[model samples]
Target chain A: NAGVIQTPRHKVTGKGQEATLWCEPISGHSAVFWYRQTIVQGLEFLTYFRNQAPIDDSGMPKERFSAQMPNQSHSTLKIQSTQPQDSAVYLCASSLDSGTEVFFGKGTRLTVV
Target chain B: AQSVTQPDARVTVSEGASLQLRCKYSYSATPYLFWYVQYPRQGLQLLLKYYSGDPVVQGVNSFEAEFSKSNSSFHLQKASVHWSDSAVYFCALLNTGNYKYVFGAGTRLKVIA
Candidate 1:
C-alpha cells in the first residue's frame, strides 16, 4: 500500500527561512496527523485533519506553524521563519478514522542552521 | 492533563528472552491505549491497542499488551524476542474529546544475540 509517503526524507534550511513538509496518506484513509519528535520533547502532536477538513490544531505553535489538507490524499505542514528549535523529525500519520489504528510515514528530518 | 509515561529510556535483552516494556498513563476517563514500534530509519507501526472488552490484546509479531484501568497501565510483552525485534517502542493515549494522540518519550529496545 506504500503506507504513508513523506517527501524529502531530510531537509536542511537556514534559520529564518521557510520549510514545508509533505505527507501523502494511505489510500482510503480519512484522518491525517502531524507530529514533531526531538530528544527533548519526545513526540508532540502538532495537528490533525479528517476528510480534508481541519479537525484540531491545538498542538501547533501559535505563530509560525500552519497545516493544510487540500485534498483527501495529501497534507502539508509549513513552518515559517524556522528556528533552531524547529529542527526535529516531522512525522506524518493517517488512519481510517480518529479511533482507528494510525499508519505513519518515515518522517522528514528538518535541520535549521 | 492527559499524558503517557514510559519510565525506561532503553532496555537490552538477550535474544529469545521474554520481554516486557512498561507504560503508564494519566487520564480522567477511559482512554484508548496503543503500543507502536519503530525500526531504525522507519516510521512507527502499531503493535497493539486496547479500547475495551479485552484486557489483553494481541498484535503483530507475537506482541501483546495488557490494559489495566485500576493501575492506569498498559504494558507490552512478548513471550520470546528475536534480534529483529530491536526497535523503539512508544505508548500513546487518545482521549475521547481529542483526535491528537498523546505519546510517551519511548523505550528503545535492543535485543542482543
Candidate 2:
C-alpha cells in the first residue's frame, strides 16, 4: 500500500503570508486527522474528519485555522496569515474508523519566518 | 479532558538490550491507547494498540505495550533492541467511543550498536 501522501514535504513562508497544507489519506480509510507537532506545545490535535464529515474541530484556532474534507480521499488545512509561532510539522493521519489505530503521513514541515 | 504523557524525552540503549518506554494517560473513562514509531524524515507507523479486553497487546517489530488501568499507564517494551529500532515513539489516546486521538510529546529512542 502507498499509505498516506502529503505534498511539499517542507514549506517556508514569511509572517502574514497564507499557507495551505494538503493530505491524501490511504485508500478506504474513513477517518482523517490533522495535528501540529512542536517542541514546546508537543503534539496537538487540530481537527478531524470522519466519512467526509467534520466531526470535531475544537482543537483548531477559531480565527486563523480552517480545515475541509470535500471528499474522502483528501483533506486540506489552511492557515490564514501564518505566524512564526505557527511553525511546526503539519501531520496528517488516517484510520479505518474513529478511535482506531491511525496511520500517519510524512508531515508537511511548515516553517514561518 | 483526556491526555497522554511520555515522561522521557529521550532514551539510549545498546543493541540487544531490553527496552521500555513509559506512557501514562489521564482519561475519565477507559479509552483506546496506541504506540506509534516515526523514523527520521518519515511518517508515524502503528506499533500496537489496546482497546479493552487484554492488558497486553503485541505490535509490529516485536513491540508490545501493557495497559494498566489501576496505574493509568501503558508502557511499551521489547525484549531486545536493534539499531534499526532507533526512532521517536509516541503514545496516543482516544476517548471511549470517539475517534479524535490525542498524542504525547514523544520519546526518542536511540539504539546503539
Candidate 3:
C-alpha cells in the first residue's frame, strides 16, 4: 500500500511569499502529523490531527504558520511571508491512532530565497 | 518537558560489522519508543517500535531495538551491517495520551567497505 502522500516534493518561494504544502494520510489512519526538518533543528513537531479534528498544534508558529485538516483524507500546512529561515523539509506523517507507529511521506522541501 | 536524545551525531562502521545506535528519552510515565530511518532523498520509515510486552522488538531489514525502562533508553541494533544500511536514524518518544511524538537530532550512520 502506498504510505502517506505529499505533493510538490520540492518548492521554491521568494521572500515574503506564501507557500502551502499538502499531505494525504494513509487510508483508515486516524492521526496526521506535520513536522519540520532542518540541519540545525533536526525534527520539530508542528501539529497533529485525529479523526479529522485538530488535536494539538502547540508547535506551530504563533504568527505565520497554520495547518488545517478539513477532511479525513488530507491536510495542509501553510507558511505566509516565508523567510529564508523558514527553509526546511516539511514532513507529513500518519498513524493508525494515538500511540501507534507512524508512517511518513517523502516530505516537501521548501526553499525560501 | 518531554524529549528524546540521540547522543551520537554520526557513527561509522566497517562493512559486515555489528552496529548499535543509542537513544534515551525523558518522560513522566510509560512512553512508546520508536526508531525511524531516512535514506538519502527519501522519507522516514519505521525501523522498530516498543509499546509494551516484549522489551525487544524486531523490525524490517534485520534491525531490532531493546527498550530499557531502568535506563530510559531504546537502542537500535543490527547483527551485520550492509552498505545499504547507511542512513540517518532518529529515536522518538510518543508521549502517553498526549499524541505528541518527540524526535531526537538523529544519528547518521555510515558503513564503510
Candidate 4:
C-alpha cells in the first residue's frame, strides 16, 4: 500500500498568497484527517472527515483555513491569504474507521515567505 | 477541553540503554491512547495503541507503552536504544465518539554513542 499520499512535498508561498495541499487516503479507508505541525504548537489537528463528510474542524483557523473531502478517495486543504505564521508542515492521515489505527503521509512542508 | 501533554521536550540516552518517555491526558473517560513516532522531515507514524484490555501494549521496533487509567497516562518504553531511534515521539488520545485525535507536545529522543 502506498499509505496516504500527499502532493507537493514542499511549497513556498509569498505573504497574502494562496496555497493548497492535496491528500489521497488509503484504499477502503473511511476517515481522513488533516494536521499542522510546528515547533511551537507541535501537532495540531486541523480537521477530519468520516465517510466523505466533515466531522469536526475546531482546530482550524477560522479565517484562512478550509478543508474539503469531495469524494472518498481524496481531500484538499486550502489556505487563503497565507501569512508567515502559516508556514508549517501539513500532514494527512487516514484510518479504516473511528477507533482504528491511523496511517499518515509524508506531509507537505509549506513555507510562507 | 480534552488534551495530551508530554512533559519532557527533549531526552538523551546512551546507546543500548533503556528509555522511557512520559505522556499524560486530560479527559473525563478513558480514551483510545496511542504512541506515534516522527522521524525528521516525515509524518507521524503509529507506534502503538491501547483501547481496552491489557494496559501494556507492544509496538514496532521494540517499542511498548503502558496505559494507566488512574494516572491518566500512557508512557512509551524501550528496552534498548539505537541511533536510528532518535526521533520525536507524540502521545495522542482519541475519543471514539468524536473521532479526532488530540496530540501531545511531543518529546524529542536522542540516542548517543
Candidate 5:
C-alpha cells in the first residue's frame, strides 16, 4: 500500500492567502487524523474523521481552519488568511480502525510567508 | 482529558551505548500507548504499541518499551544504539473512548559515534 498520501510535499503562501492541503487515506481504513508539527509545538492534533464523517475537531483553531472528508478515499484541510504563525508540517494519518495502529504520510510543509 | 509527557526535550548518546527515553501519561481508562519515530524530513513511523497483556513490548530496530500502569508511564529503551537511530521520539496515548491520540512533546535523540 502507498500508506497515506498527502499532496504538495511543500507549499508557500503569502500572508492572508488561503492554503488547502489534501490527504488520501489508505484503502479500507476507517479513521483519518490531521496533526500540525512545529519546533515550538511538537505535535498538535487538529481534527479527525471516521468513515467519511468528521468526528471531532476540538483541536482546530476554529476561526480560519476547516477540514472535510468528502469521501472514503480523501480529505482536505483548508487554512484561510494564512499567517506566518501557521507555518508548520501538516501530517495526515490513517488507521484500519479507531483502535488500530496508525500510519502517517510524509507531511506537507506549509510555509506562510 | 488525556495527555502525554516526555520530560526530556533532547538526549544524546554514543554509538553502542544503551538508551532510555521517558514518557508519562494521564488517562482515566485503559490506554493504547504508542511510540513513534520521525526521521529528518520524513513522517512519523510507529515504533511500538501496547494495549494490554505484556507490559514490555518490542518494536522495530531493536527498540522496546515497558508499560507500567502503576506509574502511568511507558518508557522506550534500546540496548545498543546506532547513529541511524537518531531521530525525534514521540509518546502517544490513544483514547479509545474518543479514538483520538494525545501526543507528548517529543524527545529528540542524537546518536553520535
Candidate 6:
C-alpha cells in the first residue's frame, strides 16, 4: 500500500505569498484530516472531511486558511499570505471511516520567510 | 474544551532498555485512546489503541499502552527499546460518537546505542 501520499515534501514561501499543500489519502478511505505541528502548539487540528464533505473545521484559522476535498482521492489545504507564524509541518491524514483508525501522510514542511 | 497533555517533552534511554512515556487526557464520558509514533521525516504510525476491555493493549513493535479511566490517563510502554525506537510519540483521544481524535503535544524519545 502506498499509504497516504503528500506532494512537495518541503515548501518554502515568502511573506504574503500563498501556499497550497496537497494530500492523497489511502484508497477506499472515507475520512481525511488536516493538522499543523509546531514547537509551541505541538499538534493542532485544522479541519476534517468525511465522505468527501467538510465535517468540522473549527480549528482552522478564521482568515487565510481553507481546505477542500473536491474528490475522494485528494484533499488540499491552502494558506493565503503565509506568515512566519504559519511555518510548521502541515500533516494530512486519512481513515477508513469516521469510526476507524487514521493513517497519516509524511507531511509537507512549510517554511515561510 | 477537550485537551491532551504529554508532560515529558523528551525522554532518553539506552538501547535494550525498558521505556515508558506518560500521557493524560481531559474529556467527558468514555474516550477512545490511541498511541502513535513518528520517525524522522516520516508520518505518524498507529502503535496501539484502547476502547473498553483490557486495560493493557498490545500494539505493533512490541509496544503497549494501559488505559486508566479513573485517572484519565493512557500511557505507552515498551518492554525493551532499540535504536530504531527513537522517535516522537503522541497520545490521542476520540469521542464516543464522532471520531474526533485529539492529540497531545508529543514526547520525543532518544535511544543511545
lDDT of 4 by residue, B18-66 (tens): 9999999998887899999999988889999999999999999999999
**Which pairs clash in the backbone of model 5?**
none
Q: Candidate 6: where are CA atoms >4 Å away?
A: none
Candidate by candidate, in order, the iRMS in Å equals: 0.8, 1.2, 0.7, 0.8, 0.6, 1.0
Across residues B73-110, which tens digit of lDDT does each residue of candidate 2 receive?
99999999999999999998988556678789999999
lDDT of 1 at A16: 98
DockQ of each: 0.88, 0.83, 0.90, 0.87, 0.91, 0.82
Candidate 4 — which pairs collide? none
Error of 6 at A45 (Å): 0.3
Measured with C-alpha atoms, the lDDT of residue A108 in candidate 4 is 99
- Model 6: what TM-score? 0.96
> Model 4, which residues run further than 4 Å from truth?
none
lDDT of 5 at A89: 99
Model 1: residues with Cα > 4 Å off, grouped in runs: none
B7-104 per-residue lDDT for model 6 (tens digits) = 99999999999999999999888788899999988889999998789899999999999999899899899989999999999999886566778998
Q: How do the candidates rank by TM-score, highest first?
A: 5, 3, 4, 1, 6, 2
* Candidate 6 lDDT tens digits, A1-105: 999999889999999999999999999999999999888988888999999999899899989999999999999999999999999999999999887788999
lDDT of 3: 0.94
Please give me the total number of clashing residue pairs in predicted model 1: 0
Please compute the TM-score of chain B alone for each predicted structure, in the order given: 0.98, 0.96, 0.97, 0.97, 0.99, 0.95
- Residue A113 Cα positional deviation in candidate 6, in Å, after optimal superposition: 1.5
* Candidate 1 residue-wise lDDT, A27-76, digit = tens: 99999999999989989888999999898998899999999999888899
Q: Model 5, range B40-97, lDDT digits (tens) per residue?
A: 9999999999999999999999999999999999999999999999999999999998
Evaluation by TM-score, superior candidate among 2 and 3 = 3
Clashes of each: 0, 1, 0, 0, 0, 0
Write the residue-wise lDDT of candidate 3 on A1-113 in tens digits: 78999999999999999999999999999999999999998999999999989889999998999999999999999999999999999999999988798999999999999
Q: TM-scores, in order shown?
A: 0.96, 0.95, 0.98, 0.97, 0.98, 0.96
Candidate 5 local lDDT, A6-111, one digit each (tens): 9999999999999999999999999999999999988999999999999999999979999999999999999999999999999999999999989999999999
